[model samples]
Target: MAPALNVELAAEPRSAARSRRATTEWLASVCGYASSCDIGQDIVLAVNEAVSNGIEHAYADEDGVVTVCGRIEHTAPERRPDGAGPCGAFEVCIEVSDNGRWRPPAADPGHRGRGLMMAEAAVDHLALDKGESGTVVTLRRRLGCPVSAS
Candidate 1:
């Protein structure tokens, strides 16, 4: 794998599905050693949640950009099987930025406040930044599964 994986997306709420697909492909390719459908689903959900939140809370009806980055851990070659052992866990990071008036609305007892929470639940870590232009959310998840059958 490369040193880092990066993907940038325009502010298109309807295009969230595209972003989701890209993330799925990336995860499958980068972690294509272990087979775990559950883990794959987790990564997909996290990506969907983050992208959805970015569209709803950050961009709303305006325009902006969202960035996704991934970095794989490096392991010793001898420990690796056939010099192709595990690629190690991946730090799947996502950053969403928009140029619209937005705030991560209070986590209320409602549906709108769920995306972030679900996203957080799906990943290992999540960070939020709210400002005048919009909101930026950073999410990370370690993928331990492969794309084969899962």
Candidate 2:
């Protein structure tokens, strides 16, 4: 089974930073040596943006909760072209959801509306689902890693 992180917190300004810290620490614990690379930082940044969007846009009328879930999965290793060995790879998936109504952006979004763009830039895949209940932002990235000997 892969390592995972599930955190639910109040939808507030501080929740973004809290999620960032939690994700950073969790990645370090599960990703091992690869956590120091740029992919780790990219994952954290994308997660932070998703959480911040939920807190800022989702709970405009009332109090609500935000949930951040993350997991790392090892994929099938591919043989290198040079026949050196198998090249290991892993995919990290993180979902940030909020239990609040989705609010349409203001007519004139000043220095805003860039959350999705920024998130897309940081990860390999980004998807947003908005429904009557709330909104969910998913970030996924696959990166190469050193293969561990069994």
Candidate 3:
């Protein structure tokens, strides 16, 4: 089993790069042991998008903090009485959260606002939570599978 990663950084533009580097290193270390470097790369891309969004959109102009956490889990598929195929595997789960409320971006054709969409496309599962205090984005991708599966 790989060790979990948890990091807290300032909600600034520069922190996005820092978060990406840290996440990349951590994922590489974890996936290298499992011989799943491709999955790690995909995770880094998805994480970068989410972290960048948190810094650029969630905090905007105010001071805030972003928390990033990651872990690997093994899940067993639910058994069906009808004898369906089994689907159990290891997966990497990452969560990026910012302590600021979410605001919709203005409708500007020239402006690029597809980070979340890209993240959704890159990962197997993506979830977003927006509340009075903050927003959290969760990304998950299964390991030991082809990139298309993710």
Best by TM-score: 2
- How does model 3 score by TM-score? 0.82
Give per-residue lDDT, candidate 2, residue 26.
79
Any runs in candidate 1 off by more than 4 Å, and if so which? 33-36, 74-90, 106-109, 132-134, 145-150
User: Residue-wise lDDT of candidate 1 within 69-141, one digit each (tens)?
Assistant: 6555433323234566674334556665555566637757565567777888987888878787566677776
Clash count list over all predictions: 1, 0, 0
lDDT of 2 at 101: 85
Worst 10 residues of 3 by lDDT: 141-150
Q: Sort by lDDT, best first: what order?
A: 2, 3, 1
Model 2 residue 119 CA deviation in Å = 0.6
Question: Per-residue lDDT of 1-150 in model 2, one digit per residue for the tens?
Answer: 445889997988988889988998877776555355787888888998889889888888689999999877677777877998877467888999997887777798898898878989999999989998889999998755652322
Candidates ranked, most accurate by TM-score first: 2, 3, 1
* lDDT (CA) per prediction: 0.64, 0.82, 0.79
- Write the number of the candidate with greater lDDT, choosing between 2 and 3: 2
TM-score versus the correct structure, for each prediction: 0.69, 0.86, 0.82
| All-Cα superposition RMSD per candidate | 5.5, 2.8, 5.6
**TM-score-best of 1 and 3:** 3
